[model samples]
Target: MGVWHRSLSRFFSPDEPHAAEPQVDQESNLHLEKPISEPLLKAISTNDLPTLRALLETQDRQLFSQIAQNGTPEAAAYLLSRHTVPEDYSQYIGSADPILHPTQYLIRESARYGNAPLFRYLLTQYPAIFSSQRWNNESILLSAMQGGVGIWRVILDYYPAWKDAEFAGHHGCVLEFLVDRDKKELIEFLLQEGLDTDRAGDPVLELARRRGAGKEVLDLIRKYGG
Candidate 1:
């Protein structure tokens, strides 16, 4: 598993039983260290634009990077208003700190939150960010699938490669991920987008069945069966 997947596995599958105690302790410690200043994070979370603007003016404007990861249109607009030239912006594009890469962070966050306008704005402003990879070389499409069908549609409309991109881990393709999550809308979307839901030896439908997926999922499988 990749670093991101390994770190998240415990929280996502807490009942799996392995080394829970130490992981819990580490998680607690990690949460104690607030990377973003409390006031700024609070302002972003509460959508207090005035407080956010004041914080940016008084505090280090560099802290504005935090808002890019917030996945809110307001935060995105504020960040865009302060856009530097492409030359200067390059410094932040691939920063070692993932959160500092405004475009990449915004793309991932927007996908996760189903914020099409924000995603579109970032794509228009920084098309190069789409070429960047996140954890395990996963594409923005994988992140969008994790959100829902709306996110998938908004991103796939602009970046069709997402449909074919396979995730690094056992999650496999977008179809498999949607099936595992029981995301009926995304499953249908992928099918409509030409995903071979009934490909030979593809266990996606079987897995969904074992998960006790409802009639919607079963009907999708039947409709698309080859």
Candidate 2:
């Protein structure tokens, strides 16, 4: 994020001299100037969730997404509950401009943190963000897997593109990890989705079973042909 130079309005600056001096200060300085949205930066740092909610409610949603990457994301999530996600969320993010902010930060923070309501709002408003196999590799589906089936429900019911993404991300079909560490029902949900066994050579049910997942879950996996 760079400084957004406010262009002088010709109507208001008709008599004001064009900046022949190049607008550079003569005095030498060591400190960098504030970026354009410094106030927004300051507010999020201060955890001013109310103000954040209001500002995001009015600004382009992608700006909010960018802010999420650098700001107090937990507070932002709280604020998101109070605001309505723009119906045009994708339009704000999927720009023709290649330099536009990346969508990963927003998706990772909102979805991975188990902010079910906020995730739901974003999924409904910005389907393209979740239309791929990739979660931020840093936190990834590991979050949703740990969050709960309710969280999965929030994703699936709202994000129509999620199933394909899950498949592409090695098909979020198998619960090969510790089921005891997370709710068992998520495995069942994946099974019902017609998830096949043997995801890229990882035997879906046996992996979890080997890891001490309950026989009950393993049986469900077998029922699903894992």
Q: Identify the leading candidate in terms of TM-score.
A: 1
Q: Write the per-residue lDDT of candidate 2 for residues 145-187, one digit (tens) a residue.
A: 6555666777667543443343334444325542555455776
Question: Model 2 RMSD to the real structure?
Answer: 16.0
The parts of candidate 2 lying over 4 Å away from their true place are 1-110, 131-140, 158-174, 178-182, 198-202
All candidates' TM-scores?
A: 0.57, 0.44
Clashing pairs in 1: none
Candidate 2 backbone clash number: 0
Which segments of model 1 are wrong by more than 4 Å? 1-77, 81-99, 134-139, 198-200
Global lDDT of model 1: 0.58
Worst 10 residues of 2 by lDDT: 4-13
Cα lDDT, all candidates:
0.58, 0.49
Q: After superposition, how far is residue 88 of candidate 2 from its true place, in Å?
A: 17
